[model samples]
Target: MKIKRVSEFVSIKRTVENGTDEQLLAVKAIIGNVKKDGDSAIRIYTQQFDGASLESFTVTVDEMAEAYGDIDKEMVLIMQEAAENIRSYHQKQLRSSWMTTEENGTILGQKITPLDSVGVYVPGGTAAYPSSVLMNVIPAKVAGVERIVMVTPPNQNGKIPAAVLVAAHLAGVKEIYKIGGAQAIAALAYGTETIRPVDKITGPGNIFVALAKREVYGDVDIDMIAGPSEIAILADDTARANEVAADLLSQAEHDERASSVLVTTSESLAQKVAAEVAKQLAELPRKDIAVKAIADFGAIYLARDMNEAVKAVNELAPEHLEVITENPMELLGKIKHAGAIFIGRFSSEPVGDYFAGTNHVLPTNGTARFSSPLSVEDFQKKSSIIMYSEAALKENGAKIATFAREEGLEAHARAVEERLK
Candidate 1:
């Protein structure tokens, strides 16, 4: 980690990936083929990319049972508990259909409707993310979405990870497909013969998957295109150097592009944390990845005061923000623009990533300035409700007609005027 004065520090710059011309063309062709050939196209791509030739893509009851048997009983219970926590938290976000009635018999309101269906694309290469399963699927389930389909690539032996399957089952997802990459995204967006089209898609994936989602966006809604993970800690001298280093590394190990930053008022604490980060990096299982991430994106800034530190953090707008000051709550009102805020030394970043009720699917890069974390609202749609009685229309129709006429929409004007007559 490099140490610098707050005035000299520059925020990490991570550009959003726009796939190469070759990759974009490939994704376009994949989507086109899936649209034309349907299930057969998916089968061909599955064999080529995943190296598994599966006659069937759907996970069967027998396979689900086998997955349950394969995972440890204790781990299964932990997943169940995590699912419950996620469900409870998102249940609070549900909005009821509401209407406001006027004395002139006018009724206006908003109707909240869950999407007809949703496709969750879980990444399948190298690592298994049962945590991703819980974070993505549980919100849709809580939002009352009836059809939730999950897709992940299969291993060379044509097998999905047991933990992934177990997490999906716990999250109430019945439809699981053993296919992945750009082709799986195409199938989800356009629908193959075996798979039905979904109203929206949510989940994180590699660059190809992100490109596919971008290409198919208008046809079907998609969650935001996510970037690499990030964490920014606002700590004071009272904060433990070891604990702060560990929290920063939690996100650094995620990827070489991931960012880990610390902004503090205490110069001594800043030096200690930088040294501690180096010591701990040597012990991390993903040391090579973390080392590059820390080298490329990590930093420690010494601020003149708490106010200066807070301002720097606000400018950074990290995906995850931890407040390790003497009084974390006192600064809450001043701090703004983070995807998720972890208060105090005890609330480490991973708590929200796994056990805590909050969703870990957060805005990355500097998107936290304007965007939000994945939530139940992403799985639901809002419909404005307007019911105008004869009396109300007679009173207001001429005004509406005039507005429409001013816009040069004669048909719209006439349509409203006809009702008035």
Candidate 2:
């Protein structure tokens, strides 16, 4: 890891994945075939990509029961508690439909309505992420979505992971499908013979899945085009170098493209953390991936002062930010841009990822500056409410007509005038 002055540091720029021309053509073909052929197209693609031959895509009650038997009782209990925490946290974000009425018999407000259906894609290849299942589904459930569908690739044995299925059951997902990749996204957006089309899609997947999401965005609403995981730590002399190094590696092990950085005022701590990262990197099971990530994207910036350090952190706007100063809370207001902020050494980044109530799905690659973590609001849509009484329209009709005609909207002007008459 390079140690440089904050003034000389530059945050790396990352755009949403634009697949190669060949991949784009491939995705388009897959989407077209799924739209045209429906369930048969999905079956062919599932066997070709996932190496699983399945007669039916739907998950049955027997499979759900077997999934519970596959995992231990303790693990189920843990996920149950985690689900409760997630549900409780997101419930706080729920908003009710509201209206305000005036004495003139005019009413104006907004209506909040949850989407009718949603599809959540859980990646299933090298690793199984039950956590993602919980993270994606609980919020939609909290938002009162009536139908929630979950899709994942089947293993060579033609089965979804037991843990993933257990998580889905715990999160209140009723519809589960054994399909993945771009075809799964297409099925979610356009619908197949068996699977119903959803109003929105959320969750993460491989490059093909991402490209498919980009391809189908306008047709059905999407959460965001996510980038690799990222973490930035702002620590002073009071912070422990080993603890900081461990936290950085937690994100680095996720992928070779993942980034872990440290910005600190103490030169001694900066050097020590670099050494600690090297020491810890050697012991990790995913050392190959973590080493490449640290070599390419990891760094330690030596700020002239705490103010300079905070400014640098704001410019980076990483997905995860950790403050390890003596008084971490005191610096919270000074920090402006981060998907999720972990205060004090005790509040590690992984706490929010697993056990804590906060959503693990967050903006990445400097997107935290403009976007936010996924929440209940992502599953709900808003409609403006307008009820104009005869007297109210009589008073405002002329002004409304004049404003519409100013924009050359003669039809709009006449529509308002018709009400007045």
TM-scores for all predictions: 0.98, 0.98
Window of ten residues with lowest summed lDDT in model 2: 11-20
Whole-model lDDT per candidate: 0.93, 0.94
**TM-score: which candidate is best?**
2
> Runs in model 2 with CA error above 4 Å?
none
Q: TM-score of predicted model 2?
A: 0.98
lDDT of 1: 0.93
Model 1 C-alpha lDDT per residue in residues 1-421, reported as the tens digit of each score: 8899999968787888997999999999999999999889988998998889999999999999999999999999999999899889989988899999999999999999999899999999556999999999999988889999999999888899999999999999999999899899999998988999898989999999999999999999999999999999999999999999999999999999999999999989999999999999999999999999999999999999999999999999999999999999999999889999999989999999998899999998988999999999999899999998999889889999999999999999999988866
Instruction: Return the TM-score for candidate 1, rounded to 2 decimals.
Output: 0.98
Clashes (candidate 2): 0
